[model samples]
Target: MTNGPRVVLAPDKFKGSLSAPEVAAALAAGIRRADPTADVRCVPVADGGDGMVDAFVAAGWKRVEVAAPGPTGEPSTAVYAVHGATAVVELAAAVGVAKLPGGRLDPLGSNTYGLGVVVAHALDNGAEEIVLGLGGSASTDGGSGLLRALGLRLLDADDRELDGADSDVATLLGRVSSVDRAGLHPAIARTGFTLACDVDNPLLGPAGAVAVFAPQKGADPDQMTELEAALTNWAAVLGTGYAEIGGAGAAGGTGFGVLAVLGAQVRSGIEVLMELLEFPSLVADATLVVTGEGSLDHQSMRGKAPVGVAAVAKAAGVPVVAAVGRTLLSPGEIRAAGFVGCYALSDLEPDPALSIAHAAELLEQVGERIAARRW
Candidate 1:
């Protein structure tokens, strides 16, 4: 133990490769193989998406069930985690893109009505503060649906309730009522709302949510442009200009909705996760830290999980190494972003699918080799 380097196996999930806990477990296996008594700490993290429940659960949060709307306007029940008085709400739980069937991938028709249901449930359950994870959304309603579910009214030019369809925006003339602050749990009105998002794209622009993300949500070129225009108009009606808010475009405009309508304060999803996990203090005593995600590329430089981890390690003057599934950025680019080195799991196994299937084993092997080299 004295001869081996003290390491922390902190990594986000490799997406299709491994879960965060599994990644930590595999890294622990490799560390132990290299030095039987090596000190290793595993703190799995997520940027408020699929792995959020696992991360919060591991950190001692209590899970609660609530009824919410589904992606297709059906009734659904979702789960939120409570840590002390704070509630954790993940948009993915109610209306993630994964919840939609391949045949029903209609961005225009889907809405964030389910998200409002979850928030209302949290408030009713005595949660004062909300930590909303606005990642992996399936809706494109510009939050109008969510506001409607929360008791706010969206009226057409003729003063009728508007549907969540894309065509409804053209008919929407204004918001007719204020948010229902009544019966708002005493804890909620005074509590801070922290929104977690990974993207930096603003509400509306070339790099905004619709332009950059609508294609992935199954929008054609025309639909993308139309959605952008619609959301821009929606923002105008709400009197909140989202044209320049960073991360405003996240989660198919859900970010803009929560920020504008709910009065939420935004923070980088990865940065919030790091703070929640107390990553800075953990890195201070470690000699080396290993972190990665499914892919590491030029985009990683702009606040992705791996880069967030590297930033913490870099600040503590610890050497950070990344073992990723693929490398889109060169070694120099990674180094400049604060990672000392990067190794690809794909290089060790040429087949992409095989590498993902054997991710835990590959990561463990990589960790063991790195530890051995240090020794």
Candidate 2:
């Protein structure tokens, strides 16, 4: 291998800009331009969110495309990654907020039906294990819609069907009297399910699905109340204890449904991804590690890909830095989170719009800056 400082570039996608691979590629070019002898390795990563599937695909997984419903039941083409008997499914690839029509939030009508369709497809095609990446949701249906897609029937007091798409969750689920799972996909029992997430919020309560996440989906106070009631009713109908489990609130309670209904295991998103990518070994002899995302904010600290990568680098006794689009975090906060240096495109280009548009170029510049400083 070429010799100098062994630099590892591990970053998540710069949302609305470049993909993780693109970011790493740009950085690699710049680092080489600055120091041709430096041994630079690009290990793009994601934390079980929007770019999780891409990460796996970058690591040699096969990409599979399928027609699935969007957040509002619209026709959309989504993709998953498959390798061997395991399939990697990303919720954002199905009913993510980005799929919202006109980019308008649909707090009441959005659901996870599309996500369920993808999972079912994987199971039908003989996938023995599923790793679901949960984040960027656009619903507050407590995953009832997903269950419905998987052949679970929601009935009213009179045994009439209650369609989750018919109305707001409160209006729809409030009338749900029971569920019929006789038609649940046959493979559910045999296939193992794992949830890749960083959320620890429970399914119901002040810190739960509706109270904490609904607002982000554009739920007003009234809608939050309604969704809370809806999820509570759903939990009652299922009669399961998963509503109280950590991460049950993720992806609008998708975690709860998979846990209680499908018997899924939950794990840290980054942890799962890194293990799958065999990331630790890449850092074993690295001289410096650089990781980042689009924005370095409060949310990044909550087990986002960058933070997770930093943790791994630190554990390997490697110096870690971040190259991001923008940062709302202070230097002290960045250091506390294990990053020795934090570079932001915003520092190079003040205009947010311009920064995003030229992220690839700026990231290369950032890479050169890092090399000049570190080497």
Q: Mind giving the per-residue lDDT tens digits that candidate 2 earns over 127-216?
A: 999999999999987778788889988899999888765576678878899988899999998999999998999999988989888899
lDDT (0 to 1) per candidate: 0.75, 0.90
The segments of candidate 2 whose C-alpha lies over 4 angstroms from its true place after superposition are: none
TM-score of 2: 0.94
Q: Count the backbone clashes (under 3 Å) in each candidate.
A: 1, 0
Error of 1 at 308 (Å): 0.9
Residue range 68-187, candidate 1, lDDT tens digits: 777777777777888777888888887888667564777666777888788887777777778888777776666666666666656556656554455533233233323333433344
TM-score list, all predictions: 0.89, 0.94
**Which candidate has the highest TM-score of all?**
2
Clashing pairs in 1: 128-187
Best by lDDT: 2
